[model samples]
Target chain A: MSDSCCDGNARKAQAGDCCAPDGNVMLLSCSGGSNVGQLANQACVELTQEGFGKIFCLAGIGGKLSGFVRSAKDVPRMVVLDGCEVGCAKAIFKEAGTLLRGYVVLTDLGISKNKDFARKREDIDQVKAAAKQASQAQV
Target chain B: MQIKILGPGCPKCHKTEEVVREAVAEAGVQAEVTKVTNTMEIAAAGVFGTPAVIIDGDVKVVGKVPSKEQVKSWLGK
Candidate 1:
């Protein structure tokens, strides 16, 4: 149960209702050691703030926590964002034996991977769009 | 042979159990069928999807309710 008033029942509840976290979609980001990774993390943060979905911990799943792994498996919809083709996020899910759904690779979105910590707003927006699109297509 | 249905007791999970039982009876296979409703157990079994069917330690289906015919085929009917 959420404390927010918007429960998808009110006519005022728009698509990106920020009243509460959307349980329907879960966001997982790589947050690795790269600019693209930072972008992925930033995009997820912004999306969660915008109520697109609730950001979940990939580390918990990577650590093989029973509760975290179970939650990841049980979530109705999930968006996984990876910084690069190395697919750190995807590997974590695979190692946990969890099914991957609504996956997006930042590099695949025409964003180049680099050591630069400074991420561009345009790249972040692109990642966010790609994440939303992937989630919609999958669930 | 051992058969396990993994889920959190959702409607689909129950439906899967019913179909699996029907297939077992129709196929006349000497298999023990059980439901695993524990989330931890399901994860330990390496199944991330609900309404999953595991036969003889092999995962046969995941995330969807399979038909009776599909279960029978797994039972070699």
Candidate 2:
């Protein structure tokens, strides 16, 4: 009997050992009006699909929604991906009085911010890697 | 002093309440300790975390259970 919950899944059976979705990890990304922002958003979407974590509504926290704020605060693990140094996502957590953990800034990954809406695949991959690294470090 | 433990009745929240009560007794402080399990009340207090400890309306801890010593310090012991 495998002790890991993910081991029971056929997907994990094919893919080998992997982490199961515990529903404790939350992902928040900045969907700002910029390429970097979109990169962050795109990375979060992909990561969620891969079961890295579930993408949460940053706007809810920003709007001071009670349920969203409570969920964000109570989650055992959180990944915050910001498109740039502008730190809109980070600022939201700060303003909401919630502890910001596992933060990653796309600009810090050497991906320069631009007005281009067409996000590059390489940049998206880089952001995803950074986001994964940030989340793993917290774990 | 008013002390409130805010959580949605998780095990950690229960542990927090126990730690707080013990802290109050050991600190010998004249305080009223209350457990707040209501989600709206927890959020309305401007706290987003569970197992939160509020002392006299000021949020002291959130999201994690605190040790007895930590609770005692918050009680000014």
Candidate 3:
């Protein structure tokens, strides 16, 4: 629903329509039950909105949906964002049998994991920075 | 009939619920529509995305909120 005229007819479009041609790069994020997880999930949404990449559905992959698993396997590049050291995003990739690339962990960036921490703009910036760095490192 | 709208209470999820209710009323079916907010139960129901619909234990929609007409068709009206 980015455009006012977007009546959501493009819901079935390929993820690449929002990202690189053919959707070579995929973004997966952990929406864990913690504040950091929320931050990670929010960052992915913002990143996708900014056209950094298409945010693939992590829950779909976690649910082991065949289409989602197949799509992730087809992506040549992927960024997995985890809110904490628990690495739920990474684990989803592993469970789906897809190779992980451009991984970024919020806790690795010194963000503390807590159940009650407020999601700050600064935290999202930190995750975005780390994600950008990982994408660059992939080059 | 039992209908479960699954999500973490996001806007789109709410919209889906609204549409499901409308569809049920329009179809004139005696259906109980439930909103599932629990993440674990959502996943357990085979919904990997938010704003999904479950009809009688079968997943009928996922990730997107369908129109009233579409929902009614799914309800077999």
Candidate 4:
């Protein structure tokens, strides 16, 4: 039902076929329905522009398609960005059978989740900075 | 060039990566493909959905994994 051209084709690809990488951080972020979700989305854009990591999709893993999931699982590491404490992003990774090298929750950084909220740059920075530190620490 | 397979390792992530390589190979471009597999790292990269795509640090697709042709276009093929 989506407008994008690849919607149907993406679903058709197998789950286990991994697309080889030339050694860069291919990333997946959970744009949840919360403020942190929005923050995550924005941060991904910044990171992508900054050459920090490459963005990948998350729904495909949940869909259980063969190619995307398989290629993703074959990666050296997969990062999960969970907003608040729900761990929704992590849940997707778990279902895909991929080992997560790092995991982050916005609430852990003191960001309150509220229905009527406006995402702030500072809040996104806090998460982004924290995630960067965590990634460096993991390495 | 930087190759990105955006997803948190879902089926889409795997597909994205596969398509990325195919696109890169088909285009004959040398680039680095990164798998952002860390929750904290992913958050640092800034994503709210399970599957997303960023090319060379630029968020290209947010929610869904596009097809090989779409990916090719994202890669500027």
Q: Pick the candidate with the highest DockQ.
A: 2
- Measured by TM-score, the strongest candidate is 2
Q: Tell me candidate 3's TM-score on chain B.
A: 0.94
Model 3 DockQ vs. reference: 0.03
Query: Model 2, B34-59: lDDT tens per residue?
Result: 99866667656654346677888666
Model 2, C-alpha of B19: deviation from truth (Å): 1.1
Considering lDDT, where higher is better, how would the candidates rank from best to worst? Answer: 1, 2, 3, 4
For model 2, state the Cα shift of residue B77 in Å: 1.0
Ranking by DockQ: 2, 1, 4, 3
lDDT of 1 by residue, B1-77 (tens): 89998765556677889999999998999999999866667656654445678888767765567899989998988
Q: Give the CA lDDT, 0 to 100, for residue A25 in model 3.
A: 45
The Cα error of candidate 1 at residue A32, in Å, is: 5.0
Per-residue lDDT tens digits for candidate 3, residues B17-53, read 9999999998999999998876666656543355677
lDDT tens string, model 3, A77-122?
Answer: 6678888898878888888787888998888888898989589999
Which prediction has the highest lDDT against the true structure? 1
Candidate 2 or 1, higher DockQ:
2
Docking class of 2: incorrect
lDDT, residue B7, candidate 2: 66
Where is the poorest 10-residue window by lDDT in model 3 chain A?
A1-10
